[model samples]
Target chain A: MSQANEFWVVAEYKDGELQEVTLEMLGEARKLADKAGSLVGAVLMGEGVAALADPLAHYGADRVLLLDDALLAQYTTDAYTTALAELIQEQAPSLVLIGATANGKDLAPRLAARLRAGLATNCMTIKLGEGGALQMTRLDYGAQFQRTMVCSSTGTQLATIQPGVIGVGKPDTTRQAELTTVEVKLDPNKIRTKALGYLKPDPEKIDLTEADIIVSGGRGAGGPDRWPAIEELAAALGAAVGGSRVAMDLGLIPWKRMIGISGKSVAPKLYVAAGISGASHHTGGIRGAKLVIAINNDPAAPIFQSADLKVVADLREVLPATAKRLRDMAVSDEQGGQQ
Target chain B: MRIVVCAKHVLDTSIPFEIDEESKGLVEDGLVYILNPADRCAVEEAVRLKERQGSGEVIVMTLGPAPAQEVLRECLTLGADRALHLLDRAFDDSDAYSTGFALAHAIEPLECDLIFCGSQSLDEGCSQVGAVIAESLDLPQVSAVTQLELGATQGSVSLQRKLDRGGREVIECSLPAVLTIEAGINEPRYPSLPMFMEALHKEIQVVDLDALGVRSQEVGRRGALTKHIGLGPIRPRTKITYTPESDIDPIEALRLMMSGQTAPSGQQSGDILKGEPDYLAQQIIRFLQQNGMTPEANV
Candidate 1:
């Protein structure tokens, strides 16, 4: 079943930085290839993004296939797909991994269709299953259940993993990867979509899907006056702040922090739901979190069902105590370490 | 002008469910279904586009079981001119790739100018069907679309696509393109009483896999490039509501409810605290510490 005996990670380079998911994919690819016996390849596409090859190798790419050109700088569906499809066909790698980010989601399916490959999207986990099959698991149907999928195709297997599902590995800066520069050929006239511009949230905000830890405020947490307590806990825990739909609608938090069925689905290491009743829509987004603790006054809160730890009390009291304890521990640890 | 809106029939996941061990699928007993949320937005967008243009037809389509026709009927009441139901058991358990393959073949003969689909389906959450259809038909596609406006010149459009973290990107695409709509683009209109009654009389065009020249083996389990090999751990989601019967002693039931014994949920229980705030806070810290989430790990 192995055609080229290589696992590829399509590097996502945006805003002049290598996206964190790329490093995660590289790390996961390294682990997979080490166990399965294959070379790990990374594809970096952007003008002057060749510098990213060093970090890709340090994280785990054995070979970096660089596609650097001005035409490939701004992402147009046609330009990126044509360049990537051609490379994958040339290499015929057994597996292709991509980040389930905004542009990556738009690009992977189109590339898979062009290459006649099978693709799994929003995958939470990818590993070699029985008979060395490429097994993938993802949330299904409003996050009601978890369904495992495997590529039964004879063609290349492709998957886009959700951001933050896997953390990055320690970089071995001593490593160096074999770099192969691929000549990009794309006709501007054939590009169907023109990227006019972009609208990004404030730079101070963290993307919920990419955040490793999050503390989300709910309507049950009272009004805007109580939002700061949630933020303080998030700051202590080094987590991003999220807002339930009702809280966002009430203007307790910004729209970008919204998490639920309609907003971004987040996969954090730990999630703290402060005073949230755990509506189905909100729970749908947080299902991917590794650990969840729901603090609310209502014992019958629906959020408790999904939570690993439940505290049925006023968050106004619980949050302050938790944050203070965490901070105290950090300060004591720092003093002890300095001695 | 003709616009094709593709919708999916999915389980009403708000309802509690249990997975069947044998089939590795959901238990179908006493289940209700609804249109995929994003796809409903696609339907609504199609109607709104036609309404703005003043003349055109909205052809809504879906590939599902016979009961899925309910969604199509629902679409008709929302201003869809016709419904195309691709009905056949041969198409069951089809993966995203084969599902798109069958839909592409069925759509080829229609030769519509524009195609609309949900950015992703609620069932599989695969955002690939529209792109696959576009690739099969050699048409351009714009996905995660929030807003679309016709261009000054024909054969072009100005659209805004959704990005991560509430970001949006403006883009331009040519006509005859497949557009996958995002949710929250618009509030779907509710049908008037007159329109609801009129939609009941409209006949849906039901076509089987054979009619579209699609072989049974090319789809479903036979041709699916992917297989749902296993089920992952299901978070036990038993509702907490306890309704007492008339036979039960009222005092006993009340005691059962208050003693934290109502609906034990089969041995699965999280830590429920009912103590002083300071004591509860200590419990929270201990739990976090046991989980290896110490303050030192907060870097």
Candidate 2:
């Protein structure tokens, strides 16, 4: 295994930090490359990202290529694509892996097109098959079925891996790699897209995937009045608030807070359901939770069948009571600790 | 100005799916179809641009079998001026690469000033064709555009792209580019009765690989750069065990649970509280108070 015969992971940087997906991809790439009897390399871009190469090597990259330039600091399609596509051409690696972030999604297809290469986007898994052919598995039709794609043997294989699906490899501080800087000649006039500024969302909103505990509401939550109670419970329990697909579809909540087959899949420590009927689609998402406690008006609601604890009570009453209970318990625990 | 919106007629994913015994792919028989939700957003955006300009032609296009004409017709009813249907059996099993190749070739002669597409179709969710077509046509593209504003002359597109990391990036690009729209860009309007009727009789220009000057080998699965290998089940990482306490009083169970007292072994069916509302409420309060989950009231 050598640099020319290695699999490449395109390192992604944001807010002066290497994105976790980039490390996760490197770990995955290491596995595939090892299976193929190849090595792993990484491509880093941005004005001051050269130092980011060491961590990439620790994660698994055997070699790191840096394109540090002021023009490359912020990601614009043309400049990055031109530079990366050129590198791919020069290196002609067997496979290239990129994170399926907004930037990666925009970059992968364009690069694939330039090289006439096969691309698989939002892949959950990648493996090396017989004769070292690249195989990828991705969710299709909103996870209704999994499609395994085999990259064509013609050119370099490209794939954008979904974030959070692959586990990050433990960093080996002892590992080191050779770092190389590549020069890119970018014509300012050829750059068609100009980024103006970034707009940040309200910081209070929690991403469901990152939450350890979740309090979710569904159609059975009644209406907007019950939403506050759900939020209150979540706050008391130090949990994030989520909604079922019906709650989101009816405009009761935003799409990002939705959880189900078509929405974000979560594996929280504790998943407390309020007034949810528990459609199979919803259950499909929460099956990974460590524990499921469901409260609904109907004892026989489908959610009960899947729950470890089933409480048949009106959510409007049970939610507030549960919140009050958790709050009191926390206060007493604090008092006992002081003594 | 000419705006072309690429619409996809996809199998309704909400329903059940079965693998075809013969093709080993999705079963097509008895399957319901609809315009992809994201593509609907693209069509709506195209129509809005056309209406705003009030002097441009908006064309809705799709490359699929005969049934795909329905999606184009739906777009026509949404106010697109015409439609382009790339219909042929040779178009079957096409991957995003060849599909983009075919579309880029078909659209080249049309000389479109702007091209719109859904971020990704639900069936495959690859989210690739727009960028591929843009690359094939050598145009710059913006993907997952949530907000779009055209310059006064419609020469450039200023867009806000939603990032996965808690913010949005505003980017400006020259026209004659591709823009793939996500949902929430616009609410697609329902077709009025008169417009719906007019759209049915409207002509759709159908083209095949021969007509589009694409070689047969370069249009379908033969033209694809990737192939579907097989399918497998998505396994859950954790398993749930029940803690049945239906026989125990809820208050007792709550006290036992909070005290970290172990329930007897072989616990299975979980707790099921049943009583009148007032009684249940009182019992719950007692349980909470005993578990130190509620404040000690005027007992």
* Best candidate according to DockQ: 2
Docking quality (DockQ) for each candidate:
0.28, 0.29
Could you give candidate 2's per-residue lDDT for residues B1-299 as a string of tens digits? 89989989988889987876556577667888899999999988988887887889888889998989989989999988999999888989899998988898888998998999899887888888999899999898999999988864458988999787446888888989999999778999989999999998888999987899978888789899899988655542221122344356878767766754324321214567765544554555454345333423311
Every candidate's TM-score, chain A alone: 0.65, 0.68
Query: Can you give the lDDT of residue A292 in candidate 1?
Result: 84
Best by TM-score: 2
Tens-digit lDDT string for candidate 1 (A1-339): 353979999998766668878988888899899998888999999898888899899989999999988989888788889999999888899899999998999898888888878788988778797777898888886776777888877758999987766766667899999999998888888888888898654323657886767899888865755778898888887778888998888887788889999887988767899888999899999877767888888999988877777888877777888899888888999899999
| Model 1: docking quality category | acceptable
Runs with alpha carbons beyond 4 Å of true place in candidate 2: A203-339, B152-154, B235-299
CA-lDDT, candidates in order:
0.83, 0.81
